[model samples]
Target: MPDETVTAAEPGVGTPNVERDIEDEEEKEAEQARDVEKGGVPVATGAEEVSGGKEERDPNMISWDGPDDPLNPQNWSFGQKWAAMGIVSVFTFMSPLSSSMVAPALPQISRDLGITGDPTLSSMTLSIFVLGFAVGPLVLGPLSEIYGRVRVLQLANLFFLIFNIAGGFAQSKGQMMAFRFLSGFGGGGPIALGGGVLGDMFLPEQRGLAQALYSLGPLSGPAIGPMISGFIVQSIDWRWIFWITSIVDGVIQVLGLILLRETYAPKLLGDKVRRLKRETGNDKLYSVYDKHDRSMRAILSRGMVRPFIFLGTEPLCQIIGTYMALMYGVLYLLLTTFAELWVTEYGESSGIAGLNYLAIGAGYTAGSQIGAWLIDATYRRMKVKNNDIGLPEFRIPIILVSAPISVLGLILYGWTAQYKVFWFVPDLGVFIYGMGTLSAWLAIQTYLVDTYTLYAASAIAATALYRSLLGFAFPLFANQMYAAMGQGWANTMLAFITLIIGVPAPLVFLKYGHKLRERSSMARKSRIIR
Candidate 1:
């Protein structure tokens, strides 16, 4: 997490300070020129010879710093790594917190802004924020690849912070809608970038806990935010929703400036090359990704465009994206409706209504933590069974188990909430629902990461677009939906639909997913054959 850019060299070479060794500088330059003539980057031969004795060396492997360089993200101290993970999780938490914090304040916002008293309109306020989350990942996810994760992520957060504050002053519904959408666009960067950053920082085995911790941000933030927002709305005014969250986001941004550093290997190496060239006049030193033929404009365009391309063509992305989108939409729907259900049915106060979110939060925490360890263990076991070859299908078994849990949760929450059943009944149902959702989500996300690897950002972005849009759209219609069919039958309808789509999805994917992946041009290109 320190602000140092790691420059890769041969396996064991210490990067010489270009400031010293003037006598050898000219000789080194001539040697590098000869290497270039032979179409190779000038590497220190002595460094290679020194490192070769200890381990297997791949001369063609692209590296950042030496194999064991402390500057590499892989070599960072555990404390530094955890701190970085915490920073990203905090960043990830703010957007969703903003998205749902206003749930308890909907009536206040509706009254003061002169909006119609329709629950659908009120839900739109929160859902539209989710809509921005959907749109943002499509572009931001890809842009992170071209510019590196930290820069795009921080810039997007600033954009979110700006619109969030602006939402505080909106006098009309139109302004509120516009500000919410824009703020969401900025806020969504963390959702798209969080996993990719972990991929950059940690190896596969150590990544689970970090990812599980990060997963809590999006899931728990919404649950927790309204706890405070409910109190604020009852005591203060709805305007403070924007003002208070913006202040919190500002603090997060300041901490990020201090702690978040670049992790992308290409960017780090590119910076090193530029610095080295300035110091030693070695203009030819460059990364494999660096090519004179490709302009930054082209790179940016390609990075931005690839996710959509993959989304359109890759069946793996499509199936995973669809399921994940449904899960996210349901989450927002629950957040939007929890206050109404509790306050209306159980005659709870606003603060008490908000507290029900803890059920969902508990479910999420348990699912993610348990799911993390289970996923890794499953993946490792599958790897062992497959002659030490890891298949994407290695992740499918847990997803299969989670799918039915999701259906059951829907049934429990819907039927219990329909009757004036015990308050704890609905809470337990929601907790079950939350666990199932998170479990499915963790499996889908880790599968996507494992399957796509380098293009994980784009794949996630493609999913983000639909998922966020659905998150927005679901709440907008929840009131209409429940009114049309009533809560029990309505959610039963949803459960049936979920079964139709989700149930067979995992089974099909688990059995034939490898072959399906083989047909994907992107997967083929990445050489991610199962």
Candidate 2:
């Protein structure tokens, strides 16, 4: 691969200019090494800085010390890379766990808090957390770009821990809602930034498995939470749900401090520039990020707003975001309604109904593990056929298979429960739905990361905003939708909608995705794939 560097030359000027004489490869490598020892690569031979009416060129422009620098997160050891992935995965798990942990306890909480007349308010307590999820990434994702990933992530986790612990002490519906929202706000950090961590640590070729492993946290947490909380809410006070999760989060925070390291290359190089300026008394030491004269506020404002811009302008983000949102919405809808389906239809206790969630968890795990292997293998096979060049479109084919499975699962789940048939039949449908949802999730996430390598966090944050909103709003109307339409038809409605939205997405990307990406401003700025 060609060196991924930021030269002062205009875009597309430095590489593959056949009309210009190519420099000697060995001599160029040797010169780059000497430049690294001097603190940074020069801006370019004739590059001039024009800040504040100054016309002099600054020779000290910082970047990675050649492609193999150990400081670069991409070059980190396998043990270190996996360690970072694991820590972020743990952080990712806690938020989704907390989101649905309160589901089984909602009735008890409603009764204890005297939430009478309207069950909507009670459901609000559970769904309001996802509302926070929708809003947090706009600020947190950009903050990661500016401050660094480890710092932002650890601080956000601490924020989540504090608010979540406070939730245990709530005496009123208002207090509980406030605490849950704040906790969720903090929880959004890992979801927004975790993709960027994977993008930083692994090449596109190796990201499939890492993404699949990381995905298990968010996908399985919602399924697993209700299972554990069901028993806890039965035997223990409902308040212990918050208390126990907070304690687990505290432990994860400590692990984060020990294991997580700064992965954003710009932030790392910026720090290096600051240190060199202090040690050598040279104010001209700068980085490519410093080429512009924007203030911190301006930079943050732009960063915070970029996700919305991508959503509006980029077809890839729009299509994937819509599909992921539908999948997420359905997942939460199932989480909210599955237990009720069992209790009301099958005459099972809350605890027994909650056990059905384990089927969903099992499907998620199996699907993620299998999808990981399939994605990596398929990409490798395609790369070999294409002369070792990989495209983001290689990630889309699996979703074509998974989407239909999800639609089938939804249909089966709805009809089986509506008829009040054998209990295990509905469970089997739930398991299938879980597997299908997770497989599609793995493909979408991996595609986004590969397509928007440098801006992976922002792209994911944009997609996540749509997803969180759908998750928050879908359950609010779920009971009414199911009551009016009946379980069989209601879920069939969802299945059809899923088919309409989900089926075309992968096929479109498979055929025209590269063309769409070539025209995207975000994709052009990323300049990582080509």
Candidate 3:
């Protein structure tokens, strides 16, 4: 089958002045903003386009004016690009914070709500939020593809804020459950949409640091959320947790409106095309992205099912999603169990026990920064060695280094805890594990974006589905598993599984990734796979 996806920014060789440099797209953004204010969009009327003769151009297709068009997000100024990233990171951070902040408050909530004996209901209040994570991405990720990212983000943030605040006033567990799920559904917008934004803003070679920075919110938020809340639940009412998150989310919603613009090219170009037709009285002008009959029914049908289709049909997505699921599952497993370890095994107070999560936070920070330092550098070097061409495979080599460390940490933490070793030792092992998992996770995230440049939202949604499901399911079985096997043996079993998944995943990409991409209809088109 021929490639169906068309991006206006893709370098056009046969056409004159079609090549684009997203790194420094000139000042056409100012023109685009001005045109928007005047109720239209600017055309690619560069000096080259005008001088090359308009008669030779294809007036039907709308694209950036050469590589330097400032209107392209890739060509935006460094400040603007980072500003977008920073705001999105904050959005991503708040959701995960809300997910775990209640962990420390669960006991208090159980008492207040008269569910102190029902362990299952108490856990549901915490884990049910993650279920929404799985569901929201399936719908919202695709909607962001159809609508603009900024519009969807602003709306989702507002949705999360309203429902989250409602959770603070709930009198029954059922109401709290419903409110939490809806809040998580709204919060899912950032996690689902953030990857696509990075894909839009950065090239394959430039994605490592961006991926690393964006990941900190997901990885570190869980670690930090309980640290603060342990103290809150100890001193104040459980309702404050929900109220505080809502306040922060309201602020983030405003920031998103102010800082985040439409990053998805299809949405931006589609809007521009509609404006063009209205202003010029020519209904024929359309963008390459405006292919097919894109009615609301068709868009919704395609967008809603795209994640399931990718997971079912794409082998590459299946493998990546499974690995991510296991990684995320283990992370949640630890998050659910870690406090108990400190409070019960080590005999620490609730507030003090929560502080141990800082170890994981430090490790996560180390992992993200390490990935920033290593991933793109490794990709660039490997690409140069491969005759100045790049492949998504170049992003996987760091996984080789990260996988072993993860397994080692699992063993260390499990056995040391089993033997009642020094408190610091188990914390050290947790740190190492955090560093390893986040590093590997960062590489895989960037690889997916690089591989499926156009369909990144759908691709990520596939992984997010698995990640969220595993995150929700793992905590339910964690205590039982540890009780049966003991920490040492249980961790050893987990390590073995990690080793099985982690060791070969990267090597497969290194050797056969190009071949895999050859079979993927939705992946980025490359002249040379290697």
> In TM-score terms, which candidate is top?
2
Residue 56 in candidate 2, Cα distance off native in Å? 15
* Each model's lDDT: 0.76, 0.82, 0.79
Structural similarity to truth (TM-score) of each candidate: 0.86, 0.89, 0.88
Candidate 1 stretches with Cα past 4 Å from truth are: 1-63, 292-294, 528-530
The numbered model that scores best in lDDT is 2
The digit string of per-residue lDDT tens for model 2 on 1-530 reads 33333222234665433211111221232233333333434434333357798554345767777667898787899999999999999899999999999988888888988876776788888889998888888888878767889999999989989999999999998999999999999999999889988988898889889999899988899999998888898888899999999988898898889988898776888898899899999998776555443355654665677687679878999999999999999898888888788778898888898899999999999889888888989988998898989988898899999999989999999999899889888889988988988988999999998787656787898999999999999988887888999989999999999999889889899899989977765565465423
Q: List the residue pairs that clash in candidate 1.
A: 8-65
Query: lDDT tens digits, residues 111-149, model 1?
Result: 888877677787888889888887788678757757888
Query: For model 3, what is the C-alpha lDDT against the true structure?
Result: 0.79
Candidate 3 structure quality by residue, lDDT tens digits, 63-168:
5555566778988999999999999988888998888888877778888777777666777788888888899887787677567888888888788889999999
In model 1, the Cα lDDT at residue 461 comes to: 80
Task: State each model's C-alpha RMSD to the native.
Answer: 9.7, 7.4, 7.8
lDDT measured at residue 407 in model 3 versus the true structure, 0 to 100: 88
Q: Which scores higher on lDDT, 2 or 3? A: 2
By summed lDDT, the worst window of 10 consecutive residues in model 2 runs over 18-27
